[model samples]
Target: MAKDAVLVLGATGRIGRLLQLCPPEGLALRLQARRAQAAAGKPDAGWRLFDPLEDPAALARAATGAAAVLCLAGPVPGRGAGEMADHIRLGEAAVRAGAGAGARVLLASSAAVYGAGSGLLAEDAPLHPASAYGAAKAEMEARAAALGAELGVPVCSLRIGNTAGFDAILGGWRPGFSLDRFADGATPRRSYIGARSLAQVLGALLQRPALPPALNVAQPGTVEMAALLQAAGLPFAARPAPGTAIPEVALDVSRLQALLPVPLAPADAAQLAAEWAGLEPQLRQEQSRR
Candidate 1:
């Protein structure tokens, strides 16, 4: 099998780290981080200092000779106009770079683009973004798709689900964060994919000759918030907002399933909780430093 060189932007984030740790077989990686220091000691994989917004040439350079460009770059969480502008700029840079390189492009998007919904959300579902973050992602997807069409390059917007990771599970219990519930007192269910599964899906997508315009990436089943907390062995308190309806964001992953070599199982909340428990102390220590 030939090794396909893939350029990954925002290569220092949680998802990026997982990709590095468990990359797809026969895929060579070129990881671009904001700081050159972040790439230290990663000799097997190509590394470069890149700022998508400020260094457009660098972005193009990074994409050169790459089979695919995996864009994970975006503004840090903020609802301000400046943050939204930055998010849009980052997406534009990624699309232009990938198009210039004539490589396949995959933009990491969020399920929030589907807005508040109760049933299985498909890729073709109407986008009704409720938050600034979600709106930014929707804009990115639109722009990337248009660019791909104009440049004759394939682009895929992956509406990724909740990723099972330490911060995702434990952050709910952090102070000032409240777990949401429906007005009827039912915990909202959400589809999620483990880090390993996510890596596998990305690998398969990168290797494919043609790509779908959009695909919902998630596991087979959904998990409830209360069950997730219980599995983590944490005391739960309802912070139900009166008249606020929590939406169940379950994804229809049949399209992704058809592409994968094996079917993806629903995430094991109990097992994820157990893993989070083991890292609780470390997580807390890091939180304190922040």
Candidate 2:
């Protein structure tokens, strides 16, 4: 059988690059970025230029004939107003394009939408976004969900947890980068997933006929920052940041596990950290230059 085509926005981003490297079997991928240069050397047939804010038509064109639309385009934290507006516009365009193309839409959301709170955060957890970035993501989720409903298209807002990337997780042990601690000076716990696991989960989501309105994508176990650092055999200091008190956020992945592949346990995260230790020297050099 011919493979279904899927459209991926932000095709050159961190997650996008991972999906490209390990795409789901039996799916043809169409990757969209702001410019062709952004996807240089990638397969030309699958690459296209699309600016959601400036060129909605182009985005729609990219979405045409796609079985699913994975919207991953958004501004990072601390971006200016124009960039934030663009991020909002991108979300709008994604739903419109996906609905028009008769494709399922998956919006990549963040765990920050749950705000600071202790205990397992389910998909229906109260949304009390603590920061502007979190608030923006919450708004995006709401808008996308509404638009998908209005257009009669299926949508899934995936609230992703702290993803342990090579640089962030391994390099976290170095000085100047401290982990968060509670009032008792104990390292806070969080649910985390590695990049490879995240990719597998996303691939599974794409194959589903229908999905829950929202789901928390995370690992099966909660990991303490101190334990993770210790397992990596690195010295680390924990300090409380000056801010309004917030509870440690832990995501409930029961729904995710039921639908997707089994996620890595907390011990697996520590093991992965140890495996990546050799890259710490290079990561530190890169961090110092930055």
Candidate 3:
């Protein structure tokens, strides 16, 4: 049988940008961006330009023959309800338009869905989102899961942790950056996953026969913010952690590991920093081959 063609929404953003590697052994990527302008300055890498909100026909056309759809296009935090509803709207429209029998849809969700939960978070954890972003994701999961049941389509909400390079510390680094050092002389530790590993997780899920309704995506262990900076060989001043600062946010990936061909291993600061720095070089290589 032929491999499934995966339709990737938000194909130009942080996670979708690396699909050029085509991590999955046999599957093909149907990359979709909101518009051509979002993918400017790059080669015509066959990006399907259309907003799921404005052009269901075009988005459906892009999803044609795709057995899996990965929706990564949506607003970040600090947005209004209208913006947060984009993911929900996109999910209903896309599924209505092109949900083939046995098709599976994966929506980009956040670890923020777990809120201020303590200890390792699992998919079954009750949500008490501390921020608007977290609450939005929780609602997205519930609504999408219901939509999936109604449509006879399988929808999985990926509760993803902080992706390396995109996290607050490394992604927002500057010469005079100040890190929150807690009373224990340690920086805030959060669940972290390398970009390549995340891609691999996606590939693994795409290859699966059936997926759980919700899954946590992350490396096995958490890493400290300051350690990531040190591994990147950057300097920063430390400030005493505020009372509001969170010391750690860990995700339980035991569910994820059981389904993968190879279980995810614990991560180190150096390995993660290298993964972020390597993105550009790999992109250049991909460009050269093109």
Q: lDDT winner among the candidates?
A: 3
What would the per-residue lDDT of candidate 2 be over residues 18-88, giving only the tens digit for each residue? 67656778788888878766655555548888677788888888898999999888887678756665555
**TM-scores of the candidates in the order shown:** 0.88, 0.87, 0.91
Alpha-carbon runs more than 4 Å astray in model 2 = 166-175, 240-247, 261-267, 272-290
* Candidate order by decreasing lDDT: 3, 1, 2
| Tens digit per residue, CA lDDT, model 1, 192-240 | 7765677888898888888789999888888786777778666766776
Error of 1 at 191 (Å): 1.2
Cα lDDT tens digits for candidate 3, 122-189: 89998888887788888888888887888888888889999887777887787799999988899989
Q: TM-score of model 1 relative to the true fold?
A: 0.88
- Itemize residue pairs with steric clashes in candidate 2: none
Model 2 residue 133 distance off true place after TM-score fit, in angstroms: 1.0
Where does candidate 3 have its weakest 10-residue lDDT segment? 94-103
Ranking by TM-score: 3, 1, 2
